[model samples]
Target: MAKDYQGEEILVVRRSLFDELGEFQGINADVDAYLPSLLNPENNFFMDRGAAEDDPSHKQLIPYCIFRVKDDQGTRYLHYTRGKSGGESRLHAQVSIGIGGHINPVDQREDHLGFDTYMAGVEREIDEELNIEGGHTNKIVALLNDDSNTVGQVHLGVVHMIDLENDDVAANEDAIANLAFTTLEELRGELYDRLETWTRCCVDVIEEL
Candidate 1:
């Protein structure tokens, strides 16, 4: 049992079919048992736990994105931070996506019921990076485990339309380089390859909305 940085007890819930069905409407059964099947390498629907744990390169934090699409123009924008793309040159660049990070020791509490720890991580990350006061209520569009890829766990969050035009909702310069909007078409065409499973899941949710 891996202890959280804050010396808190951590629980690793096995992937289950019930968890999957619970994410969507309708369809009820003993779904909890099926979570492992979805994560199996042979199925490839999601990543296997072995791969996620074996990889040493991945930072253990769960990353999330907060994206929005304009009602009139239908253009979507993602928030991201600027970081060093480790390579020979050690060059730094900007990435387009919203804020999210790993689960803190405070997040893995028994008192915090109903809400998932991953959701709590996203909420904390958004406030830290964007300096905005909000929460993870009904904003989560999809959840994904990225064991198949180099990046670790990821969750996609879709916030409902709000007055983003207000200048007060600005991103922290210390955390992010810039924030801007982009179209879904642009995301699919230019940015799709760079996206993680959570990004794809968010697209699915956006399609329905």
Candidate 2:
């Protein structure tokens, strides 16, 4: 049977309003104060992923979540992966440092306020993609974009950094693999070229991660 996308309706904004992603911002509580004016309610609509991805006139908001895993003393490394079996084929096993998907309407409700819908989507995607074994703290890190590629042109990533206090996070599905906690130096070296466009673009804002 074909995979049921469950009527996915991704929220998106104009590609131009961001302007070099405003040099990429890693926001905390202040994201709420800044987001309302950025999102045009009319431009934000739900459509099939296939069509939504090809339209460059708009940029979809995908919450890109990357968790930092640690154990006893301090930070170990950052978590990342690539889509594998059962996962979306378009990713084609390419490396993706962040874990998130489109903000669907089901991820929203009347109770959602400010960037809540996007944050809700972020939470939903992380749960579906990874298995966290212990305590963790999540914070919205940055708004990332790349008009440099076809896929990048159509999507804008809001980076979320999750600092996991345990060493137990793992990919729970065959659709995802190569789960690892790699250092920033390694990411800048060997794995740099392997990253998906949005990952490379968002790297600057998440330097502390």
Candidate 3:
């Protein structure tokens, strides 16, 4: 059964704001240009997820994090498959490199909403999904958008690159399956075809970097 989002309130920005900030089809690396205004409290609000999911006028802000570790051979990235128990029914069973989800009311601070709240939600989502045994550095490297499919129409992604000192990571939830670290070549090769649309876009962004 599909999970109900009626009672949930997630953070979102107006689609008009996105267009006004200069919209693009895929991943945009220019975070500085768009993030400030998009994350501004005046430009965002918490809406009922049931309505937001079907409403393209609002884009749900999702922090899509990609974990990485540098080894003797080269840098490897963390990847996994979304299991049946995942929240987004449309993305279940799809391969992905991102580790994140919707920013909700719980992320807010005393009726306040901003980047700090968003980051708090990001950290909460990551901890709920994975167990990392080492220190890491996180950077917001890009923003993802895809309007070609039903799943992408009302969502916006903030891509994060989390560099770990060690690749000691494990899945903490049933939603994350076959969690493992893989090389860029492996991901760009055979696994490319299996990646979710947003993950595919992230792979392209990584390749260009």
Candidate 4:
């Protein structure tokens, strides 16, 4: 069964206020600088998607990452499949370079401060989707948004780039499958139509040759 988290509260901020931070219209971002402003828990808080869904003004913050693998064969990126029973219906069969979800109320505990604490959900999502055999490094790169569309209207994507020390990452659940590693060109051409909106818009983050 698809994970129905409709009523569960998730963190978000008004787009007008989020926009005050600066231009986050598409993919232009500097994580170190942009992130600090968003860390203010007061500016953001939890609200059920059931109520926020139709309200594009309320942009649900989502932590997203693109896992990269570099080996003797060169560089490759991970793209996973969304099983039919996946929580997100619009993403089924849509190959995506990004992996992540929303922040919950429990995740906002006052004690857990700083970067690691803020990215706790991002770490959790990465571990749940890919099994890493070696040490991995990740960094926030850009902020992605597309308020033009419905999904884009309701969600804001904080994009990160993660590079693995080794090439031993694989799918950890049925919800994620087709663990394929492909070059930027390969992905851009082959998975062109299949790429999700966020991935398609933020491809450059993972398109490194």
lDDT of each: 0.42, 0.65, 0.91, 0.76
TM-score of each: 0.51, 0.79, 0.96, 0.88
Q: Give the TM-score of candidate 3.
A: 0.96
Better of 1 and 2 by TM-score: 2
Summarize candidate 4's per-residue lDDT along 1-209 as a digit string, tens digits.
43456588877877777778775567866666567766666567678867776688788888878888888989888887778766677678888888888776656554343355568867777777778899988788888887767778888888888888977878878888787788888777878888888888877545431
Comparison by lDDT, 2 against 3, better one:
3
- By descending lDDT, how would the candidates be arranged? 3, 4, 2, 1
What is the Cα-based TM-score of model 4? 0.88
Candidate 3 Cα lDDT to native:
0.91
- Candidate 2 is scored at a TM of 0.79
lDDT of 3 by residue, 21-94 (tens): 99899989999999999888999999999888889999999999999999885899999999999888889888
Error of 4 at 187 (Å): 1.1
- Cα RMSDs, all models: 8.8, 4.1, 1.5, 2.6
The clash count of every prediction, one per candidate, is 10, 2, 0, 0
Candidate 3 local Cα displacement, residue 131, angstroms: 0.3
Ranking by TM-score: 3, 4, 2, 1
Off by over 4 Å in 1: 1-63, 69-72, 85-98, 108-120, 133-138, 153-168, 173-175, 193-201
lDDT (Cα, 0-100) at 177 in candidate 1:
53
Candidate 1 lDDT tens digits, 1-209: 43123332222333343244344321112323433343232332222333334334322333446555455666556544355431101113534454564445556434342235445655666667675433323343333443444333222122332234322356655545556667777767776665545455454455643
